[model samples]
Target: MTNEFATLSDFRALLAGAALADADMFAAASEHNMQLTKPPGALGQLEDLALWYRSWRGGDNAEIAAPQVIVFAGNHGVAARGVSAFPAEVTAQMVMNFQHGGAAINQIARVNGATLDVVALDLDQPTQDFTQGPAMSENEFVAALQAGWQAVDATADLLVVGEMGIANTTSAAALACALLGGAASDWTGRGTGVDDAGLSVKTQVVAEGVALHGGQGDGLETLRRLGGRELAAMAGAMVRARCLRIPVILDGFICCAAALCLAKTQEGALDHAVAGHQSAEGGHARLLEALGKAPLLHLGLRLGEASGAALAIGVLKGAMACHASMATFAQAGVSDS
Candidate 1:
């Protein structure tokens, strides 16, 4: 969480305080896995998943006791540029839908045993269109990010961060290009099913935004300059979850962009984050690659708001169950054939 600092230097201190994962449990889990009845590395990804939990928790045993998906909702001023098929108002409507238990994220969260939370930012402001000046004042961005960090569940065994906004893809793409030296055309995709012309405009907007603010500073600085409220909040949640030793599963492209920002501020922030899925959006795979993460699932999932992470939580649960339940070779009384 953000510390009580009113200045940029002090804010940097708060961001720099994200803690690292301890490996004592990881060492023990590795030894236990080798002693399990199965062949070495038989469980494949499940073993990796179990070890991940143990490592981050700094314990030999870990379970996803309470899973959560916190969705940060905001509106994007760049949507005025006609980037998305849906208007910015849809962001609020979807927030209502999510609260009403009607959106895809709600259903997935219920089925996967995750509590859903929504942090609605100022849709009315939408941050001054980045194409003009800074999207928002540093004060507004800092406060919104702090709100997100506070929204994270400190007791949660697994944290999944998602976002809701119109034309946020443009912001995410621009941030990606600026921080990773990518081209807008390569990172921008059809968000909310834009037409060919809309795609061109979106691409141009991202390209222009990146050119305007690219290479200005580190990841967090780039995020502050080119990101939307939802994106900034997601980064805050990620950094805080890592600080609390809670594992995080990042949603799609927008989520990954925020994760990249968190990673920049805290080296190995990705150590506490797992890519829930590879988004169908353009540049998500590239972003994941840049973060050195292999997603757990892929279903062409493009709906933001943590839908992908909600669905993937079950997989993590199943993997953790296997690690916690399987009997060792001696317990099973099985020969090492």
Candidate 2:
């Protein structure tokens, strides 16, 4: 029951402004954190993340609401380049696993009380329709983007975007290079554990793809040239989150590349994004740095099925609880020490 509308700047502005949480919420949460019997700043980034969530919601009372996790699953034809160790069939198999509620993300979402939805965008599905399986037209890319928005519509209060496709990391790196104006070597990272020789091959292959696309700032062109459907759908989801006023949690390196696309596509899409975790990929930190985002955790995880974001949801909930239930120093009758 999501509502779709023409692009509106006023809507985005209103949404952005609404996220500014009140000062009392912050004061209370800080006080509560201090009273937890730990010295101030003891929790480090966890406290910061809690405070950030409190501020983002405009108050401690701002309900997280019906949070939803959407795993955009697709097969990338570019895996033929040895960019990934796993076969592309893994994408479809994982999607089937997700549908059967047996994936890691599924269990994580269940624990977090988050609704999980799988959007199977068959851009490279061989049995279905088109002859051109690997590449996509601009129209198709845009359509996939819109479809992602359409899927998340009113059902999600917050969205966690994840992708499942082998070698799509190459596609993601190339897309990041195109939109963010960097070399493929700058964005490319190891996918599924390539050896030294395989890493060399991967770097060269991604560089060639970036050169083939040849764009300084054209996000759509870059996506059509090297971005997979999962990435495009991810871009669409990020944009739609801004338009719809729902915050989104991004997974790892490949998912961050999708964020890079939306950041370049729209002027302010980055403001609504939350990084779930940092990956072992070398490019992840650089990308997060470029985005001015600090991730919620760094567990050296590279499994990209929104598992990282799912883990962060627990922290986000704890943050909201502190914001809402914490008593201020004055209310607690405690002296500011």
Candidate 3:
């Protein structure tokens, strides 16, 4: 909950000492799952998801009553290179849309009964173009990360961090290629529905960025060099959630990419998080595979702003409902055999 991460080393220290889910609660939840009336493994991943959520919540009968969705917006200098279908100004404009409750995430969060907050990080001043140099200096990176860290509500039981930054997919692709050891084309995608020519341009930009700044072998350093402000904030918020033992449902490719930085940093930095959905973006599936995350939904969603994760809240809610409210075989007068 403290925003004292003044330097990248501070972040490293926090990550190194990050907490894990309550093992006792996890075991208890697992045993409780067996006592439920439903056939064993009938709910499939939902059963596992419930237990996972309970472990982090540190309660045998924990429910996601207070879920928080945060959408971080920032402008990317890389957008100047024509990496996205939309202009960089769209980032700020979309932030306004979110504030006015006109965006898809607003409706999704409201319908799911989750509180939404939008954070804009220095949109008036975009990060440096990574193809030329590091995207953000140490101070800038730390500020962005602290913005994300401070945005988390300690009272929330669940967290979902999304982004609204133009050319951010390009940034995510570059970060992925840098951290996960892949070619740019393998990680690049036509974000925001770019055409064939635009896709090629985006891919080339990713390759260029990676070739220039890749191989640092440090996740935070790679992020400072290649990630956007919103991306860094998402990483920070996820770390904050881990520290608070709040479970997280990651949004899309960009969100996963932000999480990858943390995953690559510590052994189990993302232990409290899960992929909300596999996005329609070309690189999202590969990114999820790299993170060892199986998404809860796959509705071909490419819209960010935590929309996908917000929708998947119901899925977790359903799992928690069954896990918490279901009667045991003996109580229901049902035969175990």
Candidate 4:
């Protein structure tokens, strides 16, 4: 795929100039929702969700017919530090499982009628251990972002980006701590089912990485220093989705950390996206709170393959169906008392 951005500056420019949702369409959708046979606000958050979707889609009859899920896989050198319960090679093996349709995200995507694409980024060349130094150089970081930007399908009306990387949750914690100005312990969590001792190690690693790389006040730089290739790609995909006016259902902690990079870089950068669900990861709730995003579901999920977001697609589709297909009081021959 062609590179849309040659430098982080270019990407930042795109984020700064990204278009906002269509107000006219949003107003129309809100009015139509009130006219439905059901009482106003009866659908609760679904009502707002449908309207928010319509605003980006720019139509009174917007429907989620073409949703796309992209799962990015990358190896992190930090896994060698015993931050996770799984080996780094599991990232590549899980990518294969996704390709073979054997993963939970595969089944969830299929059920949501969404096409899935898996992008494996240099699994053989794991990033540098971030505690020692930056995870990726600027060129490598830009390349990862372009990988995510090119992975998006223009035909897709909605987008969901996920990741598969061992020790990525550690990366996410460090990234979040660097961006959100919190202690490492507040952002760190037991990723991949790490035991208590492992969690302590993970927390210390996060602290060290953030101490070495944090407080730069540059989101992109922090992302390059602390985030994985897959995390960068997820950030890239979300930016591309914004440019295309495609609404996104953000996944869990890792996905949110990637998004936080964009959000911190530009105001309203995540205006086209919504939190799909809150993960069981200890830091996920804090991340969501920082983003000012209330998750649509909270089933204690921490599976990172975009499983939660893909499943939330059904919830969005249900909202769209009720908004676009349900009859108004006049059409249903019901009195509007």
Candidate 5:
């Protein structure tokens, strides 16, 4: 078994002297933000997110070297409950869009020059396509975890994990309830645009699932019970990314739930995570707050295609560019009285 650094401190110590680059990158980015032709704090969260990215990179004045987004595709068995407005088949259809470059996330990825990797995990229903990617099974999940570990091992400086599955929000909510130490009622929400009655039914479905599988002790058990294969696989991937000292950007609710699982399992996994956006769903805000993370975008988007993370890539790039290009107060010949 590979040794997993369980906390941010351990990961930090592991990085040791190699982490110097991260510091230079952050300091440079901070200086550049000050020279953005505005007041120092004008950009608010954008400035902060950029600085945060710099910190993650060891502040080595590093550029956003290779930004990659992995879209974890799966199906949710719970969509049969009418919880989500779209049918479960939409998951596979959207995967097709992701592959064909027809989705919003695809456009954003293209614009940012980020490579997109799609992994299909089998936690919900199985898909019919062989050309998309590997089908996630029990063995496949572990293999994907290993593959995820290797893919994100070193070369890429930043990675974002995105998901596509109708009714995944329900799975995410249940997982949140277990991992966040809350009741199902606290995390469950109208996933797509369910009617009031549909919402009520949706909550009951999640509640029942929680009741059936609630006592698994918050890590793998929570994953085993409420997690889809993709969610489970991503949970491990998030931990591995943190262990490898790479930053992981989480897409909306589903991804946040996966992050929550990893954070609960590993003490400082949250340190490696950047919340990409808050979903319109009710529980997403609570999840972000639990992690003490603020998202980079909130376009009221509920789509689960990693689009928000893709858009935030630009903000990160800007932050990196600002750090690399901005002149210092001394360089600008501004006297320090």
Candidate 6:
């Protein structure tokens, strides 16, 4: 597993030594921006996003092509305990929905010209409820991550990770609390539109799970304690995208939690990603802050499945188009301000 997918130490090493976007290209993009007819910093973060892609690709004409979103679907053992408003069956059903392109993510991806795929991480057999015990063994966790690492297509120039698993927000909150020294009460939200009573139960489940594991494991141990398969895969996918130089636009709270885990194991892992949007989830803003990421869009979106990231894809494309095709002041025959 370590050889094929990289061990925790290897992940740490890879991330620590990973190269960032090219410095020369970044300088070039900044210079080119000043050459435009508009005054400096006119486009705000859009200018920043343009420069980021320029540096990421080490090119003056950076363009994102072959964008794809992979939604990892799994069933949480905790969901069987009524932690979610929806039943556990919805996880599997949603996986089918993603494959059939009937979900919101599909429509957004279609409009954005991004391909979508769903990876099912058959969790029932291996994952026990963390509230009862560890979610899975170390080997199982590694296998789940490897699935994500392998699922990344080489042709992909951009990636977005979305997840679907009933009660997953419970797992995400537990993992976040464990990693951030937060409380379940602060981290857990009413996922899937749960009522107050259901939210209370879910929070209790998270607290119990974290307590059972002492909330003191290394990255992998904590993941095994309270993480979901979809999350593990998302973290793995984030790591792989960094290695492959494909920038990832992350979805909502759940994906942010996975990004947190990635950073915990490999510092600066979030540097390769742009936060897609701010989810209305209670813990999402905190997660993005921890990663030092300001999302591209904010529409109170709490619906996961990479929908937020898909919406941001258009923004990214426009940023690139501006970067690559927008005329310089000289070409436009206009004086720079």
Best by lDDT: 4
> Candidate 4 lDDT, tens digit per residue, 1-337?
5777799999999989998999999999888888999988999998999999999998657678999999999999899999999998899899899999999999999989999999999999999999999999999999999999999999999999999999999999999998887789998888889999999999999999999998765788899999999999999999999999999999999999999998888989999999999999988998899999999999989899999998999999999988899999999999989
Q: After superposition, how far is residue 234 of candidate 3 from its true place, in Å?
A: 0.1
Between candidates 1 and 3, name the one with more favorable lDDT. Answer: 3
Residue-level lDDT tens digits of model 2 in 120-152:
887356111111232576556666676677778
List CA RMSD, all candidates: 1.6, 4.5, 1.1, 1.0, 5.9, 1.9
Candidate 2 Cα outliers beyond 4 Å, as residue runs: 1-56, 63-65, 123-134, 153-155, 181-183
Which scores higher on lDDT, 2 or 3?
3
Which residue pairs show backbone clashes in model 2? 2-154, 20-58, 21-58
Clashing residue pairs found in predicted model 3 = none
Q: Give the TM-score of each candidate.
A: 0.96, 0.82, 0.98, 0.98, 0.81, 0.95
Shift in Å, residue 82, candidate 5: 3.5
Worst 10 residues of 1 by lDDT: 1-10
Better of 2 and 3 by TM-score: 3
TM-score head-to-head 1 vs 3, winner? 3
- Name the better of 4 and 6 by TM-score: 4
Q: Name the lDDT of candidate 3.
A: 0.92
Q: What tens-digit string does per-residue lDDT give for candidate 1 at 1-337?
A: 4355565556567667766666667888888877777888887898898888878876545557699899999888889999999998999998899889998898899989889898899977887788776776788888777877789888788999899999999999988888888578999999789999999999999888887888777887788788888898887777677778888888999999988886776676678878899989999999999999999999998988898888989989987877777788889998877
lDDT of 3 by residue, 35-144 (tens): 88988999999999998988888765866799999999988998999989999889989999999999999999999999999999999999999999999999999999
TM-score of 6: 0.95
> Sorted on TM-score, highest at the top, how do the candidates line up?
4, 3, 1, 6, 2, 5
